[model samples]
Target chain A: MWYIAAMALSIGFGLSLAALAGAFGQSRAVSSALEGMARQPEAAGQIQTAMIIGLAFIESLVIYVLVIAFLLNGKIPAVDTIAAVMEKAH
Target chain B: MSLELPGWLAVAEEVFIGYFGPSYHESEAVFHAALVIPLLLLFVFLSTRRLEKIPTGLQNFAELLVELLSKFCTSLIGPHGLAFLPLIGALFLYIFTMNMFGLIPGFKSPTSNVNVTCSLALVTFVATHYYGFRYQGMGYLKHFAGEPLWLAPLMFPIHIVGELARPLSLTLRLYGNIMGEDTAIAVFIGMGIGAGYLPFQFPMMALAVFTSFVQAMIFALLSSIYISGATTVHEHHAAHGEEHGHGAHGAAQAPAHA
Candidate 1:
């Protein structure tokens, strides 16, 4: 039971942190890009394209955490396995 | 309470297994990868036959997609980017198709499998280097060397690691997105059965399709950006000439327009 809880917590905390960082990074990137475009409307096309690519790179870092979680997720104790262990304990 | 389930739901688990190997992981993603080819062939044949001066059917749709894809590539990579239309277009269409396929009740997206995504990423990796070497010849290796000569040792490994991370990032991005979408949809449907209530599927499927497009666009766009980076010198020179022309026009028009 302790093992399962730890596993769940790590995955939850891991992704939450990742998403937090990613969201902040993306908003900053877009905000900066918007500021640039607002100052130079002629450069809006270039800024928009660069913004999309920058946002993807930022998002991918978060996805990397999810990938690690996915690999670890398989190792989590299944409910059936835990139930069987409880029955054996009783 | 017993409920009726769609016949297709029953067959959803079935997929044609690939004969390529022992079917490592015994997963059917391999078969789906193989299946994309014949599907494309059939689609192309059906859509392109009997071209008319004015297309009225699938041909029109096909032409429109081609135009849109080429325009997208040109915008990102510039004029010379048209030369990369075939590679960019195929990657976009294939990734998009594989992604959307998962939304079908009985179909699985091959991209949900890491192996399939790795193969896709490998192509991008190889192309990035191949064009880099082709464009810059021996100078391509210079990119690996850090800006200052003394930093070569530190920068070389860093560059190599960063380069290697590109494919891993591409693979993980698509695989995780599609796999997560597939899992969410499956789990929701399974819940409907378990809770004895109709699954709240409409929103899930809609989100799946939407994310599928987003993922595909990201993959294709990144691939083009990598290719453009690989051939930077050529594009840089070309853009220089175009910029001069544009500058002259802007100067000439600023007074008249303003």
Candidate 2:
């Protein structure tokens, strides 16, 4: 029964945690890069390139979490069994 | 807004049995591979054939593509990057073509599969480490083990995890994005998820095409970045002062940039 709840919780929380973190990191990165570009427009090209590479790296972390979520789903207990057990408890 | 998704895509593709390594199953990915490889080869052949002094048609388009790719790859990797043109160029074209094919009505994109993406990531993984060892020799292990021998126990695992993460990330990103796009399209066409209009699906399809291009560019760009990171040596760069040609020198010159 707990396994059933754990499956959904992990899938949801795992991905959301990743997504939330990634979004924050990306926002910070883009804002900082933008500020640097604004300060010195001449170096904008370098800033942009580095920003892109850094962004990809940050996104990879979220992607890893996504894969983990999928793996977690693979071990989820049979839904009907869980439903039956839960209903009997109720 | 009724969207029609073909039935075959719902299941695996064809499979043939028992040759050398288990029953060879030709899934949608392998089927796409069968189609894409020959198509890619034909494209290369046609674009590159004929030694005309004045380029026209396919020759012109091919040259422009080569130039653009070379510029991008070299800017990322420096002088020795020219040697990588074949690998990087082929990767870009193959990925780009497969992605474009995905945009077509009835075609399966090879990159939509994790297996296909993993294979490509494996190639990049091999190339990165091979070049690292070749360029840095015994010292390449220093990269994996990190600095300070005492930290070996800690850093080694960290580096190992980091290295392994790279290919896994590449595999997942490509597979997830493309596959997600495919699924979204299918969902949209079948029931019109949000907009609930047939014409709304067109915009989604357009978005898929745009995403295909962006993902292809990101894949190529990230591969280049990884290769450059693997190949760069602080000692060699400082000693030789062989700055990358074109516009990258500006980045190298700016000490405070990064």
- Top lDDT model: 1
- Pairs that collide in candidate 2 are B3-B189
* Clashing pairs in model 1, backbone N/Cα/C closer than 3 A: none
Residues A9-66, candidate 2: write the lDDT tens digits: 9889889988999999999999999999999999887888778767876877787776
Q: Which lDDT tens digits does candidate 1 get at residues A1-90?
A: 787889889999999999999999999999999999999999787777677777887888887887788777887877898899999999
DockQ of each: 0.39, 0.30
Reference-based lDDT, residue B159, model 1: 76
lDDT tens digits by residue: candidate 2, B121-229: 9999999889888887887776665445688899788778877887888888887777767766777666655555554567878898888877787788777767776
The digit string of per-residue lDDT tens for model 1 on B116-215 reads: 9999999999998998899789877766774465888997887788789889989999988888778778778888778887867768999998899889
Shift in Å, residue A24, candidate 2? 2.6
Which 10 consecutive residues of model 1 chain A have the lowest summed lDDT?
A: A45-54
TM-score of chain B of each: 0.80, 0.80
**Cα lDDT, model 1, residue A6:** 93
Q: Report lDDT (CA) for all predictions.
A: 0.76, 0.73
